[model samples]
Target: MITKSIKGIGKAVGVMLLIIFGVQHVEAQQFFSYSQYMNNLTPLNSAYSLIDKNGTLNALLRKQWTGIEGSPSTFIFNGNLPIESINGAAGLIVMNDQFAVEHLTEINGFFAKGIQLGNNQFLGVSLNAGIRRYVANYSSLDAVDPQFRNDVRENKPNIGFGILYYSDHYYVGVSLPELSIRDLGNASTQRADFFRNHFNFAGAYLFGKEGDDVRAKPAVLATYTKGVPFIADMSTTLYFKSILGIGVNYRTNNEMSGIISISSDIIKLGYSYQFGTSATNLGGRLSNATHEVTLSYRFGQNTMSRSIL
Candidate 1:
């Protein structure tokens, strides 16, 4: 019964983990899920940089299970420079994810270019190259135990690509953001499959006319990785004159979140809170709430203020 309870707890945590965790021998690495993905999608799709005509820098932090020691946390810093000359954009993206005694950090640089396919339709493609480092200090958990005596550390090169078709009001795209070329550590190719090749499919539509005081946008993002079920996020946000935003997201795992933001022409601040349904409750053993915050700065000439997506 104790083992069953532990398994239940692990499954509950997995629903929102987004990133990977490692036991002594199992290699599990996945992508991070942020409630405010609609704002900064560069982490998911490099091509998203093309949406903004201006130079933008964004910083985001996500803290899960607040108050718990060594709980999951993530930080991302992203910058984009739009090149109208070639209808392309260049950017840098850096992300760090930590949980328990495990840490993963990746730094990447990307280039994206677009072309006009029709009168108003455009298509874009992007490529990213980076390095990923993973460290697991198992001995910290239980030094005396043989299983936890040794630590695991691995470094691997990372490559990713994205394609997007977009216009003014709506867009759709697909991307493979983490493609691992080789296995890591002692884990064989099959065991290491969990760490590589994550695909993201996303799209969004905007509602309301141009210059409208109020507008609404709905977005859908789905992710697929080996050894896990398809994960999806559905969200709808209401924008008030491009100054304030309020939205909610529901994941296929039954996790839900509420988001709010306030912004100006040069700066923006956003927040999100996530919780689980009663079906996945932990009976107060752990905090069921997660908090995320984001700050962004935009400069250069504004072609359309900000992207609706």
Candidate 2:
């Protein structure tokens, strides 16, 4: 009986150690990315508006590792409008992200223009301007510590650009959605090694005729940031009669996601659930499941298949 009690106590100590180290790693991660990224590409590349020429409004909410205090939570809004005469599109993106003692908000507006390269082929470029505000309530952690006496706060200007080559069936793009000349500030939390620029590259292809009962889309996105390993996401979605979608995604970090959506001509709703596949996974104990929901409205175009996105 004593041996069993000791074993149980040992496990408890191991778990506490895991939580301490794990939470710090979570704080280091940038949680802006989402599981339903394909539903709204504006955050990654505003130029995607070039191919999808519809007046669009989309909102998304995501909660990561449910039940964990200070886990990441995000809210995003984006709207895009098309200008047929200029072969261009304009859009706005706003996001709020909070985790641990840090909170960040960004607002950006962008314009993209596409030039015809050949039959049904086009190349597009985009430019965006924005402000990023970061505030960390370090003082809340320990009011008695001198280092935590002052909270960190900074507002910085940002500019970014994206380029894409697209047609009716497939598209590929690369973008730096947030570029800033000034740093967040001189805090240990703002380690330059981890606070560098982010790069995004993605591509997608659709298969099947417009009238087909079933269609498939395959997509891949790769992201790189300093002091982090390259992360890649690969997904395949199947759409039925352009009304219902079911998909699965795999991330390089051994994370798996399941997605589903229901759509009409004017509105669409989507949800995704994500979890790690590892035995000692964040989804199991360090945190919990990740949940994301997306809602979108589009007008002026239902002529194009949803796969085009």
Candidate 3:
């Protein structure tokens, strides 16, 4: 009887969370995030298609809230390259996110062109076009209410834009990753805001020797969404001999993380561990840390700017 009661309560809670997520997902932010954003650019800013000189490929995987049921997980794969014939840059991004009964998959293409601003400084403008495929399963609910729908799936169009300015020592960018809002269907025939516009501001600077000397980089990323509080992150990283890197980061009112990475001519590997803060402070002490891993490779002979590291 006790076991049955516990199962019943779990299902009830799941149903409630599902309903709440569905409602909030429309008006609120419905995006996946990574703690180590420094290594990634195109995910937030389409203009970053030209951030690096060599053709690049990157993959990132994140697992949030280990040991927790219905936790969130995200996976992303993206690639970018400069097209000398077109005198521009192009990229492709694919991402998958899953939490509880909700799943989101996105496939996007990016195009960017840069304007020289003298002294090796440049400004870039970009456009992104994509599709979002969303899926939800309500069959897990113990009691299927009339308001609940099962196996909901949808495909929606998405568009975004960005601008970036950069030199050897510093870089700044602003982006609207989701400029077009989408309406996900509701059970009652009333359409709700399924996707909202997301604005992102990001900047980074490098200090120390511009050549072979050790360097320190500090970076920040801020995001804003309608009807939701703003979120920001700050981080500092140290690079040794342009091959190894170590860093720490703090997400405002969220969590703290440590990272390590190794880069080579062939590939780069990075790993991060995040400890929860605030309400999850106690839970973090119980080994429920979030984990993330990243892999990136650069090909071709074109050299990337050293100042943007």
Candidate 4:
């Protein structure tokens, strides 16, 4: 009877571990979106808010792990406008990320000042302020295990800041999007909590002649966080006649991606597809790849008009 009881307890413990691991995996915080290469403007850093030459409004939607249950999805909307009179710019960014029963929403504002570097290059410094909210659903877990009967839903607030330095062709930035600490409720007379710190570096190079009808642009982005290892993305895109673009990307430990962009005088459309690597097959289950799309609009002085003037 003692041996039987021990085996029963071991089985229960195993089940609980599996349940917790599965749920946390779905909610784990991984960087979201593919176009982060396009100037690292995800609101995690305030410096990118002023990088654009003209007023830019962009939106990105990402669907990760397509067929998997409770896969992650993210949406981002951001806009930036330079204030020539003040020699700086102000911008806004908003994002929502969802995984399984967990969700996070963030909103931020950014300000930047530009310094002329001669030779048509300029340096910039930026500041950002943001708010975030995290929400979890405990009811969903109660249905799967009776041990979760006492689980309660919870919400928390987060605040963060960042700084960035950039030129026309390259940028490097660091940000802590969840720098503030908050209590996680009472448990044994002490509150348990965790803060998020994100560090980022990015750069791009333009080649193949400035006046050529076709050009090649290469870019790289790297990021690190307190609890996660470094992640890098390298990509090169061929611009055709200054209106269309095609590229390929390799993300460390993630996926190989193909991307395309089409632009008119005022609007641009972009899309990317990520193919799962062998690491995903290790689980004996075919993982769904990621799909992303972006739309952007540039208002005010057109590129053609600037050239002519």
Candidate 5:
């Protein structure tokens, strides 16, 4: 009798986990998202590798749903530089994410070449190639279901492409962050294929004079997945003498965030605090809040001293 009761509980847990996985896999972006995309753009759009004329190194750490167990956490690092000789730019991006029973890692290399459109205006196209590693740890479950007793790991290849148009004060970009799909392996004979085909568009505009005491910058980022509704994010930031900044972000009923940042000639530090406002109870129950931090360093000369916030 005890054996039968334990088996029933295990099955119940397995079913619950399956439902959660299905919902997340289908409704959300497969890749980890950072609120500070403006600070570190390479992870989202390869074409952004050349945003700065000089080489740039950036790192971001994000903790999502602070009070929730098995919540997602991400670490990303990227560096990019312009090759004036070739009229191109190149970058390297590495990201790792952990959530629930799954962990993912990706390493990508980006190359882009641009042509001068006019004074301070340019157009560029970029390509990214990478390998993705995914692993599921079912052994960690307290009561392992018989159907999910087997552990799974997959290593796959992915490629992406992007285009960007930018001038001294404004920029626009479009990209496909992932181009390949992988089977997540079955849990209890249920097909759980990984979602694929994500499209992203981002743009920003800067408002100020050559020596303005303050400036206002507005930016927007939108994403589309194959089967999910579109996700849009908009933000506006105010900068004081290009040194300190404050901003707010709105995510279409999903979240609202407050941003604060400080910058100098070579280093930048930023932080964002997000509040959940989704109509769904899951957003309120599972997610307490989201926090993200970004740090970046610029090498070589400081040709342009503007904040991308």
Candidate 6:
């Protein structure tokens, strides 16, 4: 009887694993971006749109788990413009994330209103609306299980809001991407279930005088979901002559990274490399390397000539 019970438990565990893997495999592709912590600047909070001094454009590309087959890759493009006359800003973001054999494409528009505070501090409130397309390919799983035959496509609409407070030397923000909504798709067969809420907080501090040619900037970002421990990212950047930048970052339970950035009067370029740690080391060197790049351009008039916080 004990042997039979053990066999039953093993079968149950196997079935559970199959279900979890199948569901996660599809959902994983929808949000497969390593630099999500940075991308959250827009999707997580509307107030972040007002953080920039001038009209700016930015792009990001990420590749994770280098040697692993069908690991994850992502690309994003976004632009923001501050309407100084009304203390408001407008922006748009587009992203494509791929993991395993699944993919997610999203486009969102954002708006933010900035309110002046005492002593040069400011607060901003932001809102965002967007659509996400989720696609999955189950052909790869056919060899493992012939019963897995549901390869489908889905699209969903979502809205998010955020608040931010900042000054020349420091900044902090909070945001929720999905609010409390659930089941955003209209398909008869449920393709995916998005989290009801994703909470984020970030802050940055600057060291050194404003006119100094070099300065140290330290920043931290934290994220949380229901029933999960908080994940934090700590990073620091050394800026030289207001144009060149070098930085390093560490993500809890994940990886360590090095970064380089350049900003001019018209454009900015950034690149980052992440090396996996802990259990990730078992995946081989190539599998540990993750890469990211960002590009930004300015438009319209140049009112504020510096970038900080």
TM-score of each: 0.87, 0.88, 0.85, 0.78, 0.86, 0.81
Q: Best to worst by TM-score, what's the order?
A: 2, 1, 5, 3, 6, 4
Give the Cα error of residue 284 in candidate 3, in Å.
4.0
**lDDT for each residue of candidate 5 in 237-300, tens digit (9 for 90 to 100):** 8888888889999876467889999988788999998776754524465554789999988886
Candidate 2: segments with Cα more than 4 A from true spot: 1-31, 187-195, 301-308
lDDT tens digits, residue span 170-191, model 3: 7899999776655556421322
C-alpha lDDT of candidate 1 relative to the true structure: 0.79
Decide which is better by TM-score, 3 or 4: 3
lDDT of 4 by residue, 125-154 (tens): 766666666665533544444554343334
Global lDDT of each candidate = 0.79, 0.79, 0.75, 0.62, 0.76, 0.68
Candidate 4, poorest ten consecutive residues by summed lDDT: 186-195
lDDT of 6 by residue, 223-304 (tens): 7765444567888989898788888888774567888888777777888888756553422333557788877777766634
So what's the TM-score on candidate 5?
0.86
Judging by lDDT, tell me the better candidate of 3 and 6. 3
The candidate, 5 or 6, that scores higher on lDDT is 5
Q: In each prediction, how many residue pairs overlap at the backbone (N, C-alpha, C within less than 3 A)?
A: 0, 0, 2, 0, 0, 2
Stretches of model 3 off by over 4 angstroms after superposition: 1-30, 85-87, 143-149, 187-194, 280-287, 303-308
Please tell me which predicted candidate would have the highest TM-score against the true structure: 2
Question: Mind giving the per-residue lDDT tens digits that candidate 2 earns over 1-309?
Answer: 677656645544543454475654453344478877776777888898877677889999998878766667899999989998999999899999876677888899999999999999999999999988778776665545475568877777889899999888889999998886775665335534224577999899989878789989899988888767678889999999878999999887778899999988778999999888775567765655899999998888543545436
Best to worst by lDDT, what's the order?
A: 2, 1, 5, 3, 6, 4
